[model samples]
Target: MTDVEAQQAHWAATFAAHPEMYGGQPSAPGAYAVELFVREGCRTVLELGAGQGRDTLAFLRAGLRVTALDYAAEALAGIEQSAGADAERLATVAADVRRPLPLPDASVDAVYSHMLLNMALTTPELEALAAEIRRVLRPGGLHVYTVRHTGDAHCGAGTALGDGMFENGGFVVHFFDRALVDRLATGCTLLDLTPFEEGDLPRRLWRVTLRREGP
Candidate 1:
């Protein structure tokens, strides 16, 4: 299998082995996105890489309609199963992020992701992904995403895979730099950028908030 295919298979196996891999609680970025979206009067949220639906549940509990997207079918099922009372408000989509997002233009009020942008995607792919996100948002919609930046402890710790990506323990991470972040925000309004950390290793990250500019 190619590296991309291997990565997918590895994640599938990993999730299967440990259903609660990232635990059931939402990440710090997830909570932040919830507050931002709610305070901004957002009605719909598109959560990319909604792993195990921890953050998705948080959004639902906050009374926000969330469409959770993950390439793994098992992850989608986990979201659906764990949604419980919030299932009615949760829609899960299983598809690869390498391709165009399967949603209509100007459909969502917000696009929120936690570490989704720091995946194994190349720089060009990330640029395209940002464009796709901007297209799916309403004129004044928001896109809150977090990524592990070059400043992270593991940023350069693993096997170099080119384009700021490094593979460690069968998984690949595309660490971001300010230049790439700024480039991705070309058509959008860069609202906020906050640095934070997560996990036992305390992975450092940058929480970025971008708004689609319009009336």
Candidate 2:
């Protein structure tokens, strides 16, 4: 299998084996994104890589409509289970974000993703995804995403997976530097880029917020 295919298979198996891999609680970054959305009056949201629906549930509970997308079927299943009565407000789509998203242009008021941009994607793929995200958001909409930065402890300490990507603990991650983040913010006004840590190893991350500009 190619690297991409291998990574896909690995994620499928991993999610199937551990449905609660990320636990049932929403992440701090995810909760913060929701708070920002509420403050900005964003009602419709597109959640990329909505693993286990932990964050999706948080959004739904906050009375926001969420379109949750994850490549793993197991992850989508977990989303369905957690949605429950709120399933009416939550739509689940199984899709790989590296490809064209099945969403209409200027459809959502905001886009929220946690640790999705730092996946096993190349620079070009990441750029394409960013452009697609811009297309799907209405003018002046917000985009909140988190990525693993170069300063992370596992960045260069794991087995090399080519193209600045590393395989650590059976997970492949593409580390992003400040330059790459700036490049990815093309076509959007970058509002903020803040550093934060999560996980037992204190996985370092860059929480980026951007706004789509008008034509």
Q: Write the per-residue lDDT of candidate 2 for residues 21-82, one digit (tens) a residue.
A: 88888998889888999999999999998877889999999999999998887778778887
Q: Which digits, one per residue and each the tens of the lDDT, describe model 1 over residues 1-215?
A: 66666777887898889988888888788888899899999999999988778899999999999999998988899788888898999888988887999999999999999888887888888989998999899998999999999999998997999999999877899999999999999789999999988888889999999999874
How good is model 1 by TM-score?
Answer: 0.96
Residue 131 displacement in candidate 1 (angstroms): 0.6
Question: Using Cα atoms with residue i matched to residue i, what is each candidate's TM-score against the true structure?
Answer: 0.96, 0.96
The 10-residue segment with the lowest total lDDT in model 1: 1-10
Question: Which 10 successive residues of model 2 have the least lDDT summed?
Answer: 1-10
Instruction: Give the runs in model 2 whose Cα sits over 4 Å from its true position.
Output: none
- Cand. 2 Cα-lDDT: 0.90
